[model samples]
Target: MKKVSVIVPAYNAHDTLARCLGSLVNQTLQDIEIIVVNDASTDDTWEIMSRCEKQFPDKVIIIDGDRNRGAGGARNQALDLASGEYIGLVDSDDYVAPRMYELLYEKAKEGDYDIVDSGYYQEATDTARLYTGDDLTGILDDNKRKKTYCRRRISCYQSF
Candidate 1:
């Protein structure tokens, strides 16, 4: 089984999907699985996912949606197919750092926590700003049965 399942519900996100996927496949946590759901996109989102799967056969899983399921529905489908000990949901139009999953996973293993998450940067045309700053390390010892969040100033990893 995969260590982490990264789910992406994409709908006509051809313009940014490539970069979002690029970050996933290149993650430092190589034991992760990437689930890319097409969500019936009219654009070439499927084509991009196809190429990604071809390039990373053991890492990328592509789902072709017959109907236009909204983001949450698409995520449910991918979640059902996921075979990971942990899961990460990402937007198709958003990209993450290479070490994003690695940091979160390591923290989860260290604390034996349920849900770990991190903060991300909001990209603007002229500038990028820090958002969701939470220091996940502070709450590492929280109940393993409950969700945990980490926020910090830097954008590397929080708790996810």
Candidate 2:
């Protein structure tokens, strides 16, 4: 089985899909499976995914959405087909650092946590802001606020 399954939900995201998939394909963690769900995109998103499927025949899996299901539903479909020990979610418009999943998976295995969450960097045209768990107290809900805070303290890994 693959070490991790990364689910990507794409809508009318042709412009950003290539960059997103590029990040995943170049991840430092090679033992991963990428499941791309085309949520009935009106643009050329399906074509982009098809090309990626061909490029990474062993690592990429493409799923067609007959109707326009929102991101949540698309993710649910990929989740059903996931065959990895850990599941990772990445939006079609977003990309991660090369070592993000590698570091997170290492920590998860060491700690044996049921779930492992990482901090994120929100990027704009000129700047990017990093949000650690402590900074998420007010932003996340009460339940998530506590869990997010605790994970950062327990795990020593960091992501860009």
Cα RMSD of all models vs. native, in order, equals: 4.7, 5.6
TM-score winner: 2
TM-score per candidate, in order? 0.81, 0.82
**Cα lDDT of model 2 by residue, 1-160, tens digit:** 8899999989999789999999999999999999999999999999999999999998999999999889889999999889888898888888888998998899778867556666565565443444444454333578775656554431122321
Candidate 1 local lDDT, 34-137, one digit each (tens): 99999999999999999999999999999999999898899999988999899888888877888889988998899787777665675554444454334334
Candidates' lDDT values, in order?
A: 0.81, 0.81
Model 1 stretches with alpha carbons more than 4 Å out: 125-160
The alpha-carbon lDDT assigned to residue 40 of candidate 1 equals 98
Native RMSD of candidate 1 (Å) = 4.7
